[model samples]
Target: MSLTSPAPPGGGPLRLRDFRLLLAGAAAGQAGAQIALVALPLVAVLVLDASAFQVGLLTAAETAAFLLIGLPAGAWTDRARKLPLMIRADAVRALAMASVPVAGAAGVLTMAQLYVVALVTGTATVFFDVAHQSFLPHLLRTEHLVAGNGALETVRSSAQVAGPGVGGGLVQLLGAQLAIVADAIGYALSALFLLGIRVTEERPEPVPGASLRKDVAEGLRFVAGHPLLRVIAAATGLANFFAAMLMATQTVFLVRVLGLRPAALGLVLSAAAVGGLAGALCAGALGRRFGQARVIRLSALVSAPFGLLWPLSYGGAGAVLFAVGSGAVFFGAVVYNVAQVSLRQALCPPRLLGRMNATLRFVMWGTLPLGALAGGALADALGSRAALVCCAAGLLLFPLPLLLSPLRRLRDLPATATAVTAVTAATEDPGRAGGTPGTPGTSGAPVGTEAP
Candidate 1:
């Protein structure tokens, strides 16, 4: 129950009851989300007979909250308890999902209804995720971050392996709308697991006269001013934008262009998830052996080129190409994520963790709606194959920030931020303490000096 105490030696944080319960909650939520990823679109495309552009709009609506409420949410999270927020978010999503089946049964479900559901659920997810990231530092020590993240990623990958297959089966058997009933159940289950967690946290003292705008600006400055965080934002922003494009288009591409059934589509995704499973298992070892920074760069370099295979995909045999490309991308992404996220947690002061994580999520994920719109427009105008090419090409560009920045100059990054010097070229003076435009008052606890 005491979060500050160290995990038992050798057993690590996984041995703790609360951490295991937390992990179980995450696993359940992830599985449910994955199922919805497949089911939601299937309902729109198959049941509602929506167009490619409409599907893109649906995808856009799902992620648009990151841009809409992301900043205020971050400020609010910094002032609140993470666990209870996450529980509430999950409960909200469960109710939202359960509504789909209720509406469907009453014969009132529509694409418009689907859009509202996506927006509401997605907004809840944004809060849940930010709080979840903030919650982990309280749950485990810095040394165990990578291991804990890797374990969680393993849970995610395992869910990926099973979720799509299960989702597809449910859709085939019970209908897509009813399939979402399972996702609702899953969220409720995740909330139950969260309730069982017993870790108590001391809330950070309130900053006197801390306005939302000021708090958001401080978070922005922290990320924008830090050398490592700057590149991470840029690289991930690029990757997430393109990844959204792919998400916006892939279901349409798979169903329309390849002429695959929903069941086959799910199976293909499940097969691709095997690579993610491998990546999750290997992330910690690769980070340790190759050095965390190096592992992030190398994984992307080695696997991204395989994505080019996607545009060249043709028929049943070409389905193999799409699967291979997807698998490789997922592998590289999981490896890069485990290393970088751990690094971020280690480097950030605990007081700023919510804001820091929120800023990253907004900048990185905010592009998703625009990218989804673009992908949909491109597919409508140029065809899905060309859209696929854009996805692959964009994946290759994400590493440019890393490859060109000072991150590449190092072997392994330091474990703590106190050892890092604050560096920025964003303002008129390249080396200013906090170069955030429009942010007033003294530059916050200078980059990396705040207590964890």
Candidate 2:
């Protein structure tokens, strides 16, 4: 049964109490996530004295869930209650994070433990993120997705800005083992906030004759049959691939090639995060002005060139140049994300949201582990500076998939239920004669195959 909910009275989500709680939970969770992102590696490197290979392995573990269970997890979420599932995932992550500090204090914490914690938390995160995205459409209307996403993105960016500094300081003051306690505490707080939400969620209806394999196929078809989604998936996948390469090598590069300490690295990341915040803040306005689809295309054009600058940093003041390049890259990427994600929420049917998001994540983020491993191998073979140059060049091509798609020609996109329904129909219906070339209103697809 659908909740007898009225359309939220005001434009912004802040007017809704339940939305506020949801945002708060996300804020707390992301803050903890950012802290852990920095703290976990610090513990591995500084405390346990892990090697570059170990750190690369740890990085691969962090995103391995995307490849392992990213597909079926969406089907599971589609059947389960999103709010309760998210809450439980948070609790699981909290326990995992807390265990790290306990083992560290006992002087038994090992690099093995760090990898386990990363994997555990990462698995939990995959579920939380998919459920969270699925839950938002229920909480807000399609129109508010940009505003809602922007607000949430701002919180996320702020968390990243503050979290690194906070994580670094805690590591400095207390041991890395103790610093991780803060991440555990943050997850606990997120659960508490989620518990405070009053909105009632209707249980998901089970798909008749649904097997995991069949359900996963449904999602894959949903994305692959459409042009815009397929292109977006490819673009994001490329970005993740190169970004993972950077992730696999950046820490080692910063520490060895640039000779920077952890604290300085934290400040640099914080500086880059400020650009993300600014991009989030500007997303809605940019969407309204340039058209959402145009913003996405333009964002790639603006951001990809700056990636070339990252390979040029020398040392000392060059770190400032590095931050500037990274910050600009982040700026364009965040703006692109805000527009594209909002478009998707508006595009997908409610029943398919979980699976759609999961499929997209699987397609886009599944590349991370591969990229991470490739980056590590590249560094081992070619050295960090050369690896950085190669990855930076790779980043320049991330926008190609989108540039060659119908999305590049669009001025706006369809977000109404009728339009999305039509688009879904075009994908599933075989007799539509290739479905009007995937342009908006041309048989309801953003892109599709040419007819004979």
The digit string of per-residue lDDT tens for model 1 on 1-452 reads 12554565666788988889989998998899889888999999999998888999999999999989888788899998888899999999999999999999999999999999999998998999898898887778767788899999999999988898888888888888999988998899999999997777666678889899999998888888777787888888888898898988888999899987877888878878888989999998887787777887888788888888888877686787888888898999999999888877777777888899999999889999989988888888899889889988988888887887756545576443333443223322445544222211111233533344
Question: What TM-score against the true fold does each predicted structure earn?
Answer: 0.92, 0.91
Q: Which residue pairs in candidate 2 have backbone atoms (N, alpha carbon, C) closer than 3 angstroms, thus clashing?
A: 438-445, 438-446
Displacement of residue 37 (Cα, Å) in model 2 is: 1.6
Any idea what lDDT model 2 has? Answer: 0.80
Model 1 has a clash total of: 0
Alpha carbon RMSD to native, model 1 = 5.2
Clashes of each: 0, 2
* Colliding pairs, model 1: none
In terms of lDDT, the best-performing candidate is: 1
Off by over 4 Å in 1: 1-6, 415-419, 422-452
